[model samples]
Target: MFDKIYDVIVVGAGHAGGEAAAAAANMGSSTLLITMNLQNIGQMSCNPAMGGIAKGQIVREIDALGGYSGIISDETAIQFKMLNKSKGPAMWSPRVQSDRMRFSEEWRLKLERTPNLDFYQEMVGGIVVEDGKIVGVKTSLGLTARGKTVVLTNGTFLNGLIHIGDKQFGGGRAGERASTGITKELTDLGFETGRMKTGTPPRVDGRSLDFSKMEVQPGDVDPEKFSYSSSTKPLTKQRDCHLSYTSPQVHEMLKEGFDRSPMFNGSIKSIGPRYCPSIEDKINRFADKDRHQLFVEPEGWNTVEYYINGFSTSLPEDIQFRALREVAGFEQVKFFRPGYAIEYDYFPPTQLKHTLETKLVSGLFFAGQINGTTGYEEAASQGLMAGINAALLVQEKDPFILKRNEAYIGVLVDDLITKGTEEPYRMFTSRAEYRTLLRQDNADFRLTPKGYDLGLASEERLREMEIKQKKSDAFVGFFTNTSVPPEVLNPILESKDSALVTQSDKMIRPFSRPNITMDDMRKIETVEAFIRENELDTEVLQQAEIQIKYAGYIEKEKNNAEKLNRLEGIKIPENFDYTRLKSLSYEATEKLSKIRPVTVSQASRISGVSPNDISVLLVYMGR
Candidate 1:
């Protein structure tokens, strides 16, 4: 039914596809977003939550880079929390418990309003290739839509198979049919495929729960959102979640279904997330531990459905209910839907370039679970990058590739394309090497400019950032130039467990500490007045403090990054044969030939490529 050639076409409307479509369309590309079911756009398949640890930093980066994930999350969140608040600035991450239905609704509406984006409700079965390049897609309905570039974000939907106990069905998620054709076509086209499994816990009815017997977990009194847009407000009232624990008795009851469990039986074979294991797996792995904590989270503000976190299992319904009742507060638990495992197709990301385009197929890109990533943040970040680069390819512009030091998205994509995950990869703070420079609070500081330059971030955003930067600089200058009297500063410093300043020494050094607050600065009317007059956000103030306090470390990291950049700047030819290099070890040669890293710096970071091998290669190149 269509004859127009679009600039970008995105298949699937999950977090990754949604962000990809929005980004490319917003950047002035004529984009068409085709999905199996438009109503389920942005459906949170596994959980009704967003952002945690390093994942939260990614959402903030997405926000600063003109993606709508954070904005929609903020608009639909039931409760908000800043995780790891007690830790360093690098560790602080913003998390939200969302109203699932509203989240999907908000995302659909946002996409509808976005210019240059067209929505089509249908499942794409295969891509149309011409002269070794992807030129369009073919849907299940037998219609072909042409596009300059296509981004495939088919999240857990391609030839999906769901297993509950012994029963199996074709579905991307519970109650949703699995997509076919694309995986088979791609495989036939010489692309390698692998299977990955992810599971969701049972949804329990909140109305039947006994709150009096459970410990209440509430949101912060003053809830903070993740979006830069002020269109969405923080929740005034939030539902309280309950905490429960799995006991030995519950473990014993779950084991009864071992013979029927699809995971244990030869019915299904695929690797799942290592971090988030099912209750049965947890019990079997940690046999010594008597209990495992489970959180009873609400699925939405209006719905009575509750997600039984940490209680994920592929056990039968009867066994699930019996085991759940034995837990602390789930005595009257009512299940909305039983938990099950879903196996779907994914291509090893090693076959794709750092730009997310497959090395085997030109103009074809894969992201999200299709690339073997597990979280919404991981998927969304990949979607943004892929969409941006796809649109850039259409415009004949240079690719937009972020380095490990630039953004967490960079580190995430780098890790996947380099290492090639054998299991579902989830984002963790520990995974990032330069996390100290990649704080969520300063995501806008690091990426807004890039987004603005890319035409995704609006001029207003750049203007506002410029204003904030100037104000912060002025404030820092004042802090450095203006000195506090020893009499005035001594008492404050002493109270804060800091040594008293002598004469007119600057309070900037001591003021940078975490314990130092605006209340302490009230002693000096000037600092307080400046802060009050500027209406500075606590996050901005905290970022400024970190900038001053860790100035030395930040500078050192910049220098190191610059040195690394020199090696990264030295581009390697695409057809360069590592096997021909006699100076490289066999192992290094094998690894380098496989990954085919674009830079000497990336080659050095490859697991099997040693520094000595890199040195030898560098000498051979006369560098």
Candidate 2:
């Protein structure tokens, strides 16, 4: 069955593998996606939701780069909400409550529709490396599939061990089989491996939940979808989620099972996510808190299954049932399945380059859980880059790397390679230095051209971005150039209790005021006429408004980013010995020698590397 030497081979068809395969194949590579089970392609392994906070920016980046996660998420979403609307544009994020089943279905359909991609059901045990380059993968069946490059996205499946309190079993997920052989193979090949654990909350029957007892958490009044493409649309209607809380009584019930908790006991030694901790861990750590919030989210539009968000646990089944039933909405909660903690193998990402390619093995790449990152969005971004780079490598083209200022994806990659994570690394908006410049709204403006040039993003995608850019630019230009008389601006300002202008002013000045919005400006006859005549939509108008309002802050961030780019451009010799620099601190020398950052900008970001160390490099290089 494996005759031809393909361009790319992607193992483990979770979020990362799916995107990786699609990217490579879409870029005209003969890409093969192999998984343990083909039926579970694009499965939502943890939560039935996509994008939140900083994560929403990443999904848009993926979409902007022609990846399918945003499109699939939008199509399958049962609910949508743009988070942080009260905040600035930089903090604004788009998230979706997905129909879990449909999300997976849509992903499979998209992959099937894609060109130059093939699927096979197999657990890849190890890669066949030749001379320091990945040649192919060897499956569990002892069969070899040849490819120029191989991407390992084995998300939480490698050596997986699940613990439901005292009971433990070998399984990747609840029902799925655990994968073996790959970790051993990689370890023998000199790669370091670590154990990390993560837990999921129990799924309950919606019929069993008492929504009247809990606070209603309804979807947004005007929901926005994930995809920037025309392929999907926003949900016209949305399902409501409920908010419940754990009490002192619930905590006591949960404490009964802590003795048997894999996390609490010696059963599990792996580090779990710091942010998304287990229920037992939460209570154990934050003992002073009277209650913890739990979101009762629907799994899908049609299913009876509802996810118990913020209630993740690995306690005994009886204890889980007893404690959950004590919660506000879960008065008579009947579990579909008890929550369990799963420990799995992960390879530290310092071994990977910015492109997600392994530095030791030329054509080998690692993405998803294999890289010790946590979220679905994070995994997908890595896969997209890895698949792209794999294809580019086969085509003998230059590698693609998004700069720190340009994308959150760039920040994610740079952080992982620069400072290797000890626990499951989750992305936060605070991690990004230039969050103001990397707004979700302008992802297409930043990445579509680059995606198009790589032959990954479609021409139609580029045209859409171009058209949006043109319209918004014109609208902003109008705002900058057009002046409105006091009569037109004063009336609107007075209504909002803002200072009334005594004289005529450029419309942009009034529009930039916090009290003014596009709607307020539209009241001006000329502004309304311009919008109508130009046939501008909500998106373009909003885009123009942001540019006008945040121009100063945006300009400041851009300037700062440019200054950082000077260091980014200063190349570090690949194998330069930091030990030779007598002025460098011991910590900086050790870190720089181990991480081997390609540029001074990257070196400066290292945890131990200080300002003085950066100056040493500059002086040594005669900069």
Candidate 3:
């Protein structure tokens, strides 16, 4: 039945697969997306939310790079929040509570409307390999399809095993059947496979819970969206989430099922997410805590189901219900389903290149949970990168790889391939060394140009980014050239408890004070007139202010990054015999050989390779 070979075939249709397919097809590749069930494409398997902490910045980065995640998230968002607003701009992250059904519907609709893309409903059973390269895929229904390149984004589906208390079942998700064949086949072909576990809290009927006892958690008063696209509407109305605490009584009840709990009973052998541990695990780990916080989030605008966040567990249904009822707001909670944990197969990311293509197989790539990452945003970013690289490979173009200082996507891929995660990897602002330069406010400024050059980003997007940059730069120049007298600046500074200026100086001088802000400066008639004359927008003004205020720190970080990038510029030959270097330590030799690092910088990041080893290599290369 397979007549023509596709340029790219993407397996699975979750966040990772959807982004991958869209990226490839949008880049002019003839792409096919195969899923076990098409109806569940882009389903939010765990919670009805997108973006949080560093994950939110990742969504914006994805949007800035011509990916659909931010656009879809904005379209489906029921509430919007810019987390860490109290902190610096570098820490600011935009998150959304989405309409569960709408999020999936938007994804499917977009994928359907995309050009050069086709969809098929089938479980990929095996891959057809020819001379160390992927040629096609075999389906469970005795059908085969050919493709030049294939991206596997099979999230939580490879030999998936679900656990609920002492009961176990084989399933990819709560209502989805587990996929087989490919994991075993890949392992047989010399891929090292490992198991990882993740869990979701139980879905409960919202109407059954008493909201009066819970604390109201409202959305931001002045909310913003994820997408940089003008087509996305701003959120004017928002649903309020509730916060309730699991009391000591609730913990006691949860502990009663500890013996039967799959996590503690030895039924689950895989490691779970370290940041979002199970409810049972939390209580056991922190015995002295009197209560734990749970945010009761709505599933959708119309649905009666609510997600019991922070209460994830694999305890028995009876135990789950009883323990939840003891919580403040969940005194009469009714269950939609009990919480469960699932363990799935993942390949160690060290076996892949920065482009996400496997080292052992040509034209074969992996993304999302298959690479041992844990969030929707994280998965989507990986998919977008993998898809872009795969399409470029088929077109005989150089692979697209982001540098660590450029985007969080780069930091994530680098950490995975260089260090190789033992536990599931999740992104955090603290993870980036040059975070000040990698702020969410400047993602478009940083990456939209690259996306535009790749044909994934539109001319319109590039134009918008250029305009923003020009205006911000002009504002900064104005601040540097203009002098503000004490009469114009002292009143504003004193009102904000900042020291009064003695004489007229460049506007940027006073603007650098910690207590002073652009708003305070705008209060001055001269500054207001200047803003009106220049037609500066709030975003432009803010960007300029931050640049001036943090100029010292930003330049310091840039210098540090430049020094490290020198090592990165030194390319190491592929398959170089590290063992031949007798001066290197055994541990360093083993790690360097196994990782086969593409650059001297990547080799330096490997655990066993120290700074001395890097110096040794640099000396050898110098000779």
What number of backbone clashes does candidate 2 have, counting pairs of residues 3 or more apart or in separate chains?
Answer: 0
User: How would you encode candidate 3's per-residue C-alpha lDDT over 1-623 as one tens digit per residue?
Assistant: 66789999999999999999999999999999999998888999998999989999899899999999999999999999899989988898889999999999999999999999999998999998999999999999979999999999999999999999889999999989999999988998899999999999999999999999999999999888888778897799999999999988999999999999989989999989999999999999999998999999998899999998999999998999999999987888899999999999999999999999999999999999999999999999999999999999999999999988999999999999999998889999999998998988899999999999888889999998999999899888988999988888888887888888789999989899888888887887777887899788767887999899999999999999998899889999997898878889899998888889999988988998988888889888892
> What's the C-alpha lDDT at position 577 in model 2?
96
**Cα RMSD to native, each candidate?**
1.5, 1.0, 1.0
lDDT of each: 0.88, 0.92, 0.93
Candidate 1: segments with Cα more than 4 A from true spot? 513-515
TM-score of each: 0.97, 0.99, 0.99
lDDT of 2 by residue, 1-623 (tens): 98799999999899999999999999999999999998899999888999999999999999999999999998888888899999999999999999999999989999999999988998888889889888999998999999999999999999999999999999999999999999998998889999999999999999998889989988899888777898787789999988989999999999988898888789999899999999999999999998999998999999999999998999998999999989987887798999999999999998888888988888999999999999999999999999999999999999999999999999999999999999999998899999998999999999999999988788999999999999999999998899888987888999999999888889898888987888999999998899889899878998999999999999999999999999999999989999999999999999898889999999999999999999999999899
TM-score of 3: 0.99
Candidates in descending lDDT order: 3, 2, 1
Q: Candidate 1 lDDT, tens digit per residue, 1-623?
A: 77699999999999999999999999899999999999999999888999988999999899988899998998888888888978777899899998999999999999999999999998899999998899999988899999999999999999999988889999999998999999888998889899999898999888888877778889888888897654567778887777878888988999899888987887778998999998878988999998999998998888999998898888777888888998877888888889999999999998899999998889999999999999999999999999999999999999999998999999999899888899999988898878888888778888999999999988887777776777777777767777788887788888889766778777676677667765677678777888888887665566667777777778887888888889998878888888778988999999889889998888888888888999987876679
